[model samples]
Target: MTVLDIDGIDTYYGNSHVLHDVSLTLAEGEVVALLGRNGAGKTTTMRSIMGVTPPRRGEITYRGEDIVGKAPNEINERGINLVPEDRRVFPTLTVHENIVLAHKLAADPRPVEEMYELFPVLDGLRRSNAQNLSGGEQQMLAVARALVQRPSLLLLDEPTEGLAPVIVDDLRTMLQDVVEQDVTVLLSEQNVTFAFDLATRGYVIDTGSIVFEGSIEEIREREDLLEQYLAVSPEEVA
Candidate 1:
């Protein structure tokens, strides 16, 4: 079943045409990566889905319903959640408080214990201010908050952009757990290795257009394609 179908979306930014006829789809229970370098319109594509930047043309159907002009919160309420790259958390709120606050935003919030079990480190830091947590911990918190929304489709933009290698490993594990729970994901990432570990399929976006779409194995075997579009070498990803 297709959870999301973005067909020929043309997104813009105040007269600047950013995305040109970009398209992709996510199936139920699948983790797909939108692979791109900076300025490739990955973030813009995500924003357009969430209705933060409504597309000027084409259709964005979530579970077969047209959501192109819907408000952001309206789209979210329809079971789509976004975890942005910036990892924004309540600066002064305690870890527990942040989790509790998310319940109010969630259409169907999960139990607090479930969040703790998925991220045990958060359980230990329940009393610490979000500002005091490490970068990786903050990223976990951001993801946890989004999960509480009980979304059917999750959109993650550059989730591991700046993290220690060990932390990235932990995140990969956490996301694996998320996938096991049947939450479909459309992940925007620049780290080929990280995406390889988590994605079943891939879409390569360049200069605001999708240039390649195929299975993960296809990307792994095509070093020339990766280098030409993503400027990545096989050794770096391997």
Candidate 2:
């Protein structure tokens, strides 16, 4: 089953075009990575899907219904949630409070205990102020908050953008666990190694357009193509 379909979407900001003819599909229970550098259409594509900035032209079908012009909250209510790159946990709230807030939006949220189990550290620091947590810890809380909503499709934008290498490894493990729980993920990342390791298939975008897309094995076989388009050499990820 195709959970989400973005076909030939052209998104813009003011007069500036951001995403050009972008297209991709996410199958049920599969993890797909959108790979690109800064200023590439990666974030724009995500924003377009969430209807944060509705696409100017094209089709965005979620579970077989057109959602191109739906409101952001409406899109989210339909079981699609985006954990933006900024890790926007409410600073003044406690870890537990942050998770509780998401429940207001979820029609049928998962148990709080499930969230604690998925992120054990959050359980220990349930009462701690979100502002007091470390960068990686904040990221974890952001993800946990989203998962508590029990979204069928999770959109993660640059999830490991500024984390330490060890933390990135831990996040990779956690997200793999998410996939196992039957939540499909569309992760946007510039970290080639992390994306390649977590996603079975990927789309490489450049300057608001898709340049390449295929299985990880196919990408591996074309190191020259990766380097030429993404400036990502095999050695960097290897």
Residues 127-229 of candidate 1 have per-residue lDDT tens digits of 9999999989999999998898788998999999899999999999988888787599999998888899989999999999998999998998899778988
Give the TM-score of each candidate. Answer: 0.97, 0.97
The parts of candidate 1 lying over 4 Å away from their true place are: none
Tens-place lDDT digits, model 2, residues 1-238: 9999999999989999888999999999888999888889899999999999999999999999999889999999999989999999999999999999997768999988898888887889999999999888999899999999999999999999889999998888877777788699999998888888889999989999998989977876788767876678877766
List ranges where model 2 is wrong by over 4 Å. Answer: none
Per-prediction tally of clashes: 0, 0
